[model samples]
Target: MEAWIRLSIFVAVLALMLVWEAKRPKRSGRVNRWHRWRSHLGLIVTSSVLMRLVVPLGLTGIALWASEHDWGAFNQFELPLWLAVMVSMIALDLVLYWQHRLFHRVPWLWRLHRVHHADPDFDVTTGVRFHPIEMILSLAIKAATILILGVPATAVLIFEIILNACSLFNHGNVQLPTKLEAGVRKVLITQELHRIHHSSVKRETNSNYGFSVVWWDWLFGSYTDQSRAGSDNVDIGLREFREEQRNTPFWTLLLLPFKDK
Candidate 1:
């Protein structure tokens, strides 16, 4: 039932974004959307299958198990349910923020993560493009965080939903009005900020690492307010992945981490 709810929401948000981008696309004419969507959708499907096979219990299950055994910090104390839920969600977000940073800072992990950055264009589909190995490792990290924090199952469900929704929202090719976007960026990561993260320039690529909230990037000093070439003109994707054939294929994306690029 929980899985169904998440899936339903995911489909709804993705469909909405698809239409939004179609009408108010931030940039276009770079690559064939059909080709890019094929690879992006393939990565998402492949990673989802691998996750089900490897972590069958999922993050919320881990939280429920911890609660049953009284095995984690929240369970060990007498905190209010609301307090526990709020803290757990914040902590989970913080952990993921660092996890994203580590993936970029570490050379080997970057190989897998670059599968995401290698998308020649950014859109709603690009939000779901992640290497299977990276998704598995992310699942492990999230599960461990849930266990240690004694996050309530409800909180885990909420956090996962918000996280997934934010990924699609921030990565949307549709942009907000400048004034509204400026205000939005003060809170959540807007598409403009995330777009800079996909810039081919190393400096821009390394900044704006937060996936949901903008606070982490600002607090950690990784924030880049604007792209060097301006938001619309910022060169997307890695320099090494300039050729469309090199980056936009299902098999190529799966084998990308092992390649010498």
Candidate 2:
């Protein structure tokens, strides 16, 4: 059921991206690089498979291992079902907020994260452009959180759905009406909010690290509004690694962090 929902959402998002790309004004000097499209497709398909299938299988093993262990911490806290789920979501966001910040602030960690930033264009596909190593590390953190918090699998599933949906929504190049954007920003992170985070400027990229909720950034003092012109004017991608890397295959991208540039 969840798999169908994810696939439907992915298709909807891809359709929206195609429409937006078609409507967007063409730049005279900037030629469309059609070859990169294959790499982008490869990235999205690979990540979708990993997140929707491979990670879940691995997580089942981790859950089984955790069940056999005497992890008293998982049972330490007791709360109402609603409260427990809420707290678990917030805790996950908090961890993600810091993890994202660290990816920008720490040079070594940035190498793994750079795969995401290396995209020449920003779109829905770019949202899933994370290195596989980074995804594994992220999964490990999530597994640890589940073990420590004893969060329900249902809560994890709900949160994952919301996270993926919002990620695709925000990463797509859809321009919202001012009134709509204002309303959405009050509750969810909109594309305007996330685009600033993808700015070429390190400082901008370091802010707005929250995935689903905007409040994490607000609470952590990393939130930045894109109302200002300069906030959205910056370029994207790392200056040092700006050369096109579309030639790099899936295996190479998987092993990127370990390889010398």
C-alpha-based local distance difference test score of model 2: 0.68
Model 1 lDDT per residue over 1-261, tens place: 788888899999999999999888888847788888988888888888889888788777788899999978999999999999999999999999999999999999999999999888889998999999999999999999888879999999999899989999999998999999989999999999999999999999899988789899989999999999997798888888778444387998889899898
What TM-score does prediction 1 earn?
0.98
Candidate 1 CA-lDDT value: 0.90
Provide the TM-score for each candidate, comma-separated: 0.98, 0.80
Off by over 4 Å in 1: 244-247
**Local accuracy by lDDT, each model:** 0.90, 0.68
**Relative to the unseen true structure, what is the C-alpha lDDT of residue 190 in candidate 1, on a scale of 0 to 100?**
90
- Give the per-residue lDDT of model 2 (tens digit) for 1-261: 556665687678667765775576121112144544566667667765676565664443454454456342444555576886677777777887788888877878888888887665566666777876677678878888777767655566667777777777777756677799899987788878887787777777778888878888888898998734463354655655555454535565566666565
Cα deviation in Å at residue 24, candidate 1? 1.0
